[model samples]
Target chain A: MSHGDTIPLHPSSQSDIDEIENLINASVHQSVPSARPPSPPRASIPVSVSAPSPSPFVPSNLPKSSSSAVPPPPPPPTGFGPAPNTLTEPVWDTVKRDLSRIVSNLKLVVFPNPYREDPGKALRDWDLWGPFFFIVFLGLTLSWSASVKKSEVFAVAFALLAAGAVILTLNVLLLGGHIIFFQSLSLLGYCLFPLDVGALICMLKDNVIVKVVVVCVTLAWSSWAAYPFMSSAVNPRRKALALYPVFLMYVSVGFLIIAID
Target chain B: MDPNQPEVENYANPKTCFFHVLFKASALAFYILSALFIDNFVIIFVVTVLLAALDFWVVKNVSGRILVGLRWWNEINDLGESVWKFECLDHESLARMNKKDSWLFWWTLYITAVAWIVLAIFSLIRLQADYLLVVGVCLTLSIANIVGFTKCKKDAKKQIQQFASQTIASRFSSTLQSAFSVV
Candidate 1:
């Protein structure tokens, strides 16, 4: 008979429909009942035997009927299992679920960019090189402020020379034989002997006074060294390291002041 | 959420403000006392250093405690929310998870309170007599802060439980609807 022409079963003759409805009603009744009476001993035996029969019957459909059939062949173990396209749909669904979860949990607010990890780059961006150089020059000019008494001038000159030497040493150590070495050395000479010939400036300077001069000069030099660290590009670790010299100068001054007192 | 973002609106806890004010008052007292009565430079310097050391300790301790408190508060808040979410997702699991989180929150809060009380007593003993008035003010403020925090904690707990129950009901309804649709 054609599919549409099939006769509908009468209620009296529909044993399958009756069985299904009875089964469903029994399930609903069992679910509603809180206390379930224990099954009779013989009734449990059939249930226990039937439970595993379906699973065993599924494997029996395979061709092998011998003892060797106990070891099932691995699914295409020699070849690449599946293409990306085959798994993509399920993976995409999982990703979509996770993304949706993240979206729901996240606050939809945007904030300004936070502080940079490096600060030295900021200093560089501001072009503070001129100020740094001016500070060095200012330190040298301080000597000119002193009265031209033979001893006072000598002390000032000595201090300037000491400062210059310290700067030169730092530049050399930090830059390591770069072309800037000669330029720094020349700047050092100009700082130490501004008006007079270089040899005579050094010959008459007292060693004790020169040491004091060196301390002041070293302080100025270290301050200049720290200027580059003010840049936003400078990493905190490097900035911290660069700050050590300035700290050392402060400590040294503290000791000197204490000794003098 | 970006993990780097700082979650708390204020880094300094209200409780910390009290300690800071006390420390500052003590510092001012120390300075005035040294200037008026203690003329010896060495003695003044030593006293200053000692006071500074004590101040540092107070700030460090208070800051540490506040940070711990803030972290725990956040955890509890988050846990409360999570419990609610879990309940909505699966009511069968809610009882177990809720009990675990409640126990954890209570334990952390209790331990923190005990630690704070110990620290408070220690601070009271260590602080100078001239600045005892400031310390008393700090203690009063701290007590107020504790009371406020307790109220907030209790409210949060109740709100979270209610939120979870509501969520579960809604989710359960939706699940039933979908099951009915398929059937």
Candidate 2:
């Protein structure tokens, strides 16, 4: 028989009608069970799993009422969001954010709080590109200030990169290679901020007094930016030890800028 | 919805779009051209200063507010202590912020600073110390904008934290009132 013709809509007799009515009433009773017995064990599993998960931070003593009258608790406040990273973000955004971080680092505004698990944010925040770019830029500028020829300009640029690499290597050896290579490079790179500023000031006037003041001020500023970062990177007991090398590193950078001519 | 979540409002702001490109282009062009070819200290100084001033104005008033939906200012209180005030666009507005505008504004800002530094070096090489003053002015302006904007961002985070606590308090009281009335 065809599908539609296979089933009968009406009950054939009074007994059939009574059986159907009883089946309908039984389902209604099962659904509205507050006035009846508890739900069967098999039926309760899905219901429990479907509930919204409560926060682990919430205290156990708090009311657990899931009734309509009780409102849910608000979400907890979060600290700063993750830094912009290279993978998901557009190239321009990542570059811009990194540049901003350099400025912030120079101003002693914020440090790049990198999580080991998220390489994207870490790499974006501490990318070596920034240091390299600024190094070249500053190298070119400093070379110009010193009246260096085009041939010697290359040497100055290479020297800046070499100095950065030396510090990166020293940091890695000191930390037992526990840190990312780029992180070390970034730290070294940002430390160059003061030297970069001092380089400009030195170019401003040929006076010995101004040069002394600029070098001194920049040394202090770069140290201020690098010390906290170095201290945090190493063990508390060895904080001073790690910071010592960082100081020498910045000092060397300052001396290099001063000796550029 | 969590009350702590930033409330964002998005709408058409042509002023934001206009000033973002205008200020960035003008500032950059002026910086590069003035240092490279102008040579005359007076012309270079006036152009650089005027452009820097325009950039400061545009960033503080227009691009900062419209593009990123953040604005900030420092005011001296009655006791003469400086107080920083920061305002951020609601969540909707921030969500709708054009990525292009923000990228342009920031990149130009940093580039301008770098350019000025390069110019200072060029001036020194040319044995002209006077141009250093112009370079210094431009540097201060760009650095100020960078610091102000970043500080504003930090303040917004604090505001979010405060909003979250307030929401929790209000929610707890509302639930308590309902629970007691039910008895």
Candidate 3:
């Protein structure tokens, strides 16, 4: 149909158009003449129907046989067919086919890389390596600081252990059990050998206000570390898992710092 | 929504608030620690104030500006790909604008990196180890910021390219479908 003629049909009564469409669909199916002969007969009907209509609904420039020239027949006053049900199986089947094909192709295209499908492994790597690296560096720093000042070596070592524990705990909360446990164990040597770092530091420092401040600071940092995982970018379950290690790390650091100071 | 529009306000993410509170608390704790351990009150006060100011600037300004730059980059890149479909600006003009903006972003990153390195080195030289440790923690917080900006840039580039690729692919498929139906 000509685009101009189709414009007028849009505002026509919805039920009337639907009834007309149903009638046309039924007629087409009922009178399914052999494909070779039916085309010309179907093409001729519009030419005969449009000859008398001079209304605005008809486009003058359309080919004489095209449907654009014919005014659609008025629909019956009452509803003719069953109310439209929820989408039928055939409609859903087509949608499912399209979606499955798209998803399959996308998966194939996106998942060829080594890390693409193994996010858990990636999280484990980050959790383990991040704390491992941080602890080793912290140990070296503490060793050097201890060498310079003999009395504070135990205190520094304890602080590092607490930092490691807190980091491990937060990673667990963020990454989940597998990563958290791996990270915590990997860093456990530091925490255990550091001379009861949290308690030692708490004994050395006598002030209550400093201990309270340290606790508050640690809580705040833990909350910060956990915040990004809570974003829409990360999966909810993963975010929850990641926060555990963050919480542990924060508390551990707070306690150790409070003890040392 | 037009991603091209400049970010008028900092879209405060949960991370932003968390970092703000963390940094503020860290700063306060460090100041108190320094007051207790180190005898130089004036120097500690000045450094603490400066750190606080820096943290505030980061929490307020950095992420939003980076996001704005990223959005502009994507819109310009998209415009370049669909230059023929748009009538207002020709391809050459759009390409020039894209080049200019992209360079601006790179320059900003370069400057920020240089400043961070210099500050880190200076802190190591001048500040006490405890004070430097607090700075280290603050600096490490930028790991998140860097990751976020990198991800934004990467995603923006991917999205723009994907949109162009999808449009071309859909058009090709539609044409093939019509041609096959005719046959």
Candidate 4:
């Protein structure tokens, strides 16, 4: 029977025609045509009936049998993107690891690399919590020793954070540094490490000489620590300019802690 | 892949997110209120320590892993030496990590650490030996979380280096073999 005549007789849907064509194509391509003769319905159908319009039966988009045998599945996704590890671990495990890293950072064995492209990785290594907490504790201790009120202590802390944010923002906007805001904050926060120690020492020692020595040492430490980071973050020509804000930031934090009454 | 557990994407669901923030914030708020409003220092110390421990647990297991896909644990080997194990989200997964969850994790982590250290220093100045004990525990817990993730970062670096080296080595060996066969 002609293909068009069979379409009305068997009620074969377009999908069925497509599947039959695929089977015939597969058999022909596999060199096993006699194994399953192309269904009479498909062979008799004209290319036009199954080609353009889907009128209950037909298939289009034929593959070149010689080369396109079994089209490959769609390529798997590519590129290394930021993806969280799929590890579902208990919390205690993470705590232990964090403790070890805290000690390592405190020993100054590893510094957070502000140059890291991944903000998360750089911030993670910086252990901002350890240094930030230590600095806050020391800052509060200094304020308390000086008999500063709690409200004043809050004011100073907020002012320091706000100032650091402003300086870092300015660096990003004007200097064109690609520093992530939080990562920059983390780096600047660590710059206070020396001042924290200085505060602690000045608190313990009543001698004017010791306090002065500690202040000088801390100023140098904070400046030196910040110089490398700030320089690398900004344009080479603008390194010196970038360092100015960091220098100012550190000095202000120290001044806030010491000058508060 | 249990139907019950949250899908990878849903791990950062609003409910978990809410609980995560609530637990950590409430722990600190409760401790501060107890320390400030409560008259009995003994009660204050006990409550604060307990609350801090609770926060430590919550941050470590819940927010730490779910929010950032990082976790760690301490184990003692046969020799009684302590060994640390860290797990972190793969980079591909990290790429899909929720930004808000990360923001909450890092900020809260930094603030929590600072709070504990401040309390610890306060106790030291006041010469309150009992309060120091609590401070010590809280500090240790906080440090553990930070240290675990730092080491995880290091491990990831090491793994990448190793994989690169292996690939290069295999390519070199294959090249040598092919050249020899050609000869």
Candidate 5:
């Protein structure tokens, strides 16, 4: 312990210790996945080489570094190499992990009822991204179809959708059924997938009847998908109570989709 | 909700709990005071109603849930029947709520309603029929919130009773079934 403690006394070893501490923080605490091999052993070689120098080196380095209140310059060789490697690799890995998580969530929501498999596990990892994407995408398409003030149309549509989701969640919750706040929000957004798909198709076509039929079908699909979970939230007496607002909002959105042209 | 259970006088958030009363009191004060300063009837009506509406929203959505562990709403069902719904934290959490917060919430709620009613009576006596409309709207909202929350507390009690009975019934049935199977 004494021999190890004596090394930090040397001025050159002081800078080296700071660099090693940074490296340790970056490696262990950061939890980054790097393509490059572990480089800390190579970084520590210089520190070991400087350790055996005289105690006189210690006082000279301490005063200069303490006054500056900044870490000394990292050593020349391996410092520049690993810095770039750390940034790029883990970023791509994180993106892949998050994207896959979003995709799995979408499947759980958009496909059929997966909650039947394990009710506890359903929506265990709810996120706002799916809701945000669905709401914004629906708003943008409706705006494109608007004859005038597309921006106002987008704002109104976005606000309505967002507020509708919150109010609907509160409605179910107040009816005495157990529900997670964000999970319901996420589920509500996913229920809009059918409507979103219908919106995409309707925006391309001009026939009023075609838009009506498509909107009606998609609206029913959205409401049907949302019904089981929302109805189950309240007592049997209040099942219809909790679900009406949900269908009402979906109906309004469908009407907006059909009537936009 | 046992009467014998220890009362929790301490608040989970003692410092900020006053803000609930602060908001309701300010909303009421604004509505009552705005008439004396402002000449425009439309401005008073609109702004006061807006403030009341904001308070209703906050009390319904945020404060009731946080301060007293209750939530309530009314909605129109498919057959055009209006349904009033109420939810509360189960008995344990309700018992754990701060005594001071509940006192403030219930007292402030009833006082606000009473104040609006008095204002309504004063308007009636003074023959200021126009202002009565504003007071009436505000009073209706205030009372609606109280009714909903009152029903919620009762509903929570009913649920506890039902749950206890149901658990006992199920356990008894299971034991009888096992005994019959052995025989």
Candidate 6:
């Protein structure tokens, strides 16, 4: 009886609500309804005793799982377990490698194409961490610089960068050109680093002429960084149609940076 | 069909589409008839342009988006670059727009422009230089919307077409991949 009382404890904790209701139905399966509460611990008690006599033997699972738990988890951990343990490299090594990859990708994207190779081919591995940082940073700076509507500014700047990257990619694609989606997104986000710099500088400089000149240079820089990738992606005939929006989005960010201050 | 739930019927909502047509018609009517009633050009200009501007704002910002699932704007930067901005709802939402609404929105747009152009010609034949300026301003506003929306519609349709082709291509490629695997 003591063993029967404890039997319901483990399974009641682990089993889902459906199983508990099923156990209740079994306990109350008789025509005469009992006044007992429909809790799991009490409900499962009747299931085990009648389990041996009746074919509706759900308590059979209860004892089997308990015994299974008593046995040490399969000895396969020693044989194949080494693989799982060894699968994970030292944590520091992973962090270092991912960090380096992000940096190099940022470099490849933000800087002018250094090699004569195709930008698409060279960017075999891409991480959105750099883009995410740049966008959030731009949003934060734009929000920080705003005299009013701070949260709204952050939201608009963030959404513009995120959606603009996708729309620009789609624009190029619809114009009948090939480009990888995330890589283009990464490139666009990295391009924001220039505007990110422009925003930061605008935040520091109090003068309007200084802000305007900084925004102009940075806007041109961003457009320049993105120009090769975008222009190359579309057919030469409709290249302006595709590139104009990219220029416009960057110009918008620049304007936001100037306007917010 | 439940009379309480009129939207369940297999038809487009007429109420909103009627208003869409009404706004454009009223704007045109007021601009033309204002010259007859009001002797003052400034009052006519203010009222006529006000109506035209109101229609432009409604069609550009409100009706275009709601009725046809498209919007457009042109922003000229300080550097003198004319940047055309466009917005179009995804294919699903565009499909969900009322057929009558789309029809009414577009027909009214073109017909209104034609009406204004006819007015412009009448002003030209009469050689009423002052009224011609009003027509020109109103004509320019209406045509700007037409061009913007036309380009936006083209972009949206092309996007949906591209999406369809890509989906078919992807499914075809997947089928090929599975066939090779089975082999």
DockQ per candidate, 2 decimals: 0.01, 0.02, 0.03, 0.05, 0.01, 0.01
Clash count, predicted structure 1: 17
lDDT of 5 by residue, B1-183 (tens): 334422543555554366666666776787778777866554565556656765675577666766766676543233323345565554434544565566666667788889989989998998875577668767977998888777765565555444434333443454555558669
Candidate 2 pairs with clashing backbones: B7-B90, B7-B91, B8-B90, B8-B91, B8-B92, B8-B93, B9-B93
Spell out the clash pairs found in candidate 5: A177-A233
Q: Write the per-residue lDDT of candidate 6 for residues B1-183, one digit (tens) a residue.
A: 123432443326465455566667777888777778766554455456657765775677667766766766543333323345555654434544555466567767888989999999999999876677668767877898888887876655554444434333443454555558669
lDDT of 3 by residue, A68-107 (tens): 1233422211231222211111334534643564444333
Give the clash total for candidate 4. 28
Please list all clashing residue pairs in model 6, or write none if there are none. none
Q: What is the lDDT of residue A24 in candidate 1?
A: 31
Error of 3 at A166 (Å): 4.5
Strongest candidate by TM-score: 4
Per-model chain B TM-scores are 0.34, 0.75, 0.46, 0.73, 0.81, 0.84
- Predicted structure 6: clash tally: 0
Candidate 2 runs further than 4 Å off:
A1-261, B1-15, B121-127
Better of 1 and 4 by TM-score: 4
Docking outcome class, model 2: incorrect
Query: Among these predicted structures, which one has the highest lDDT?
Result: 5
lDDT of 6 at A235: 79
Task: Write the residue-wise lDDT of candidate 2 on B1-183 in tens digits.
Answer: 333422342224466556655765676677677667765444454555666766776676567765655666543233323345565643323434554555455566567667767877886788754555556656777788877877765554444334444333443454455457668
Candidate 1, residues A101-148: lDDT per residue as tens digits? 333322110111125443122211121122223323333233333333
lDDT (Cα atoms) of all candidates against the true structure? 0.32, 0.51, 0.37, 0.52, 0.62, 0.61
How well is each residue in B1-183 modelled by candidate 3, as lDDT tens digits? 234432442332345344444555555566657767876533453455456545544432332232222211111111112110101111111121232233333334334334445556766887556545544544554433444445543443333333334333443454555558669
